[model samples]
Target: MTQQTLIRAAVVALLVPTFALTACSKSNQDQAQNAQAQLQQANKNLEQAQQNLAEAKQQAAEAKAAQEKQAAQKKVTEAEKDKAEAKQKQSEAKQASEQKTRQARSEARNQAKSESKPVCSDCGTISSITPIQRNAQHGSGVGAVAGGVAGGAIGSQIGHGAGKTIAEIAGALGGAYAGNVAEKHIRKVTVYRINVAMDAGGTRTVTLNSADGISTGTRVRVEGNNLAPLH
Candidate 1:
């Protein structure tokens, strides 16, 4: 072969190999840029998903808190209702107790009245009369009359003369003696008597101030008197 042809062939061989290497390097660089872009997109998508998850968690927490608050409110309302019902029941019970107490008192009073005994209306019981001393001047009525006359004479002395005063004194003395005699003749006061049974079954006689006609075996109950079973 010629030198010119040989030199040209060698140059061609080197040029061809250099061009293929350049092409292969460019292809590899393009592939690397594509991979980087895909990685960036994946990171962006992951960030968006994380943000959505956080928002969902926050909403769930808020809902749970609201539910708990509602439950607490319901519990408080129920407690108040229960308290009101209890108070109503207490008031009703108190009213019932008061009514029962009143009924019991009324029944007790009726029982006491039923158990009471009747007594004589006239002379309440049989008793003795203590006689006043004889020759004793019964001066109660006469003293009242004489005192009035003496007071009148004293008052008359303030307005009238001696003649009026003398007449007043004579009238006062005469009226006092007549009243004394009448009181002595007519005052035959009789007293009533009573017999009370003691707890030991003993009988006691008591003198009363008024006349009483209580026959034997006559049932009697004194006023303001009470009897109870011995303890």
Candidate 2:
């Protein structure tokens, strides 16, 4: 072989190995870049999942708070209703008590008025009647004096001296006593006594000069100190 031909063949052998090594290096770099991109995408997906879980927890907490508030409002409403009912019952009881007291007072007043009225059907009645005789209270001394003078004159004519004087004194004394008694008998009075029975519970007596057609069992009305017949 020629010398130039030998040199060209050796150079060609060396250049072929260098080209294969460079192609292998380039392929490894491309695989490393693809692995890095996949790692970044996995991290982003984990962050999004954590954010969604936090939002779900917040929503649950808000719902629980709303339920508690509704329960508290219901309790307050029930308490207010009970208070109103109690007040209404108390007012009704007070009114009923007042009405009962007024009725009692009215009944008492009516009873008092009825008790104070007078009973016209039972006032008084005539129980009995009786006649009475009464004598004069007294006589004047003029009757005795006149009787003594007439007796003395008659006795003086019967005798003389001392005997006639003794007879005149004795006769005058007897005639004076008889004349006083006779005057009293001549001045007698007659009266009637009436006894009345009162229905209010008592008795009364009345005196009259004559019986003016009054009798027992007759109903009468008692005035101050007098009695009048009932029709």
By lDDT, who's the top model here? Answer: 2
Candidate closest to the true structure, highest TM-score: 1
lDDT of model 2 at position 209: 74
What stretches of model 1 exceed 4 Å from their correct place? 1-5, 113-231
Q: What is the TM-score of each candidate against the true structure?
A: 0.45, 0.36
Worst 10 residues of 2 by lDDT: 135-144
| Residue pairs with backbone atoms closer than 3 Å in model 2 (clashes) | none
Q: Report the Cα lDDT for residue 45, model 2.
A: 87
> Could you tell me how far off, in angstroms, the CA of residue 87 lies in candidate 1 after the best superposition?
2.5
Angstrom error at residue 84, model 2: 1.8
Question: Model 1, 145-165: lDDT tens per residue?
Answer: 855575556545553578677
128 Cα displacement, candidate 2 (Å): 48
The 0-to-1 C-alpha lDDT of every candidate, in the order given, reads 0.65, 0.80
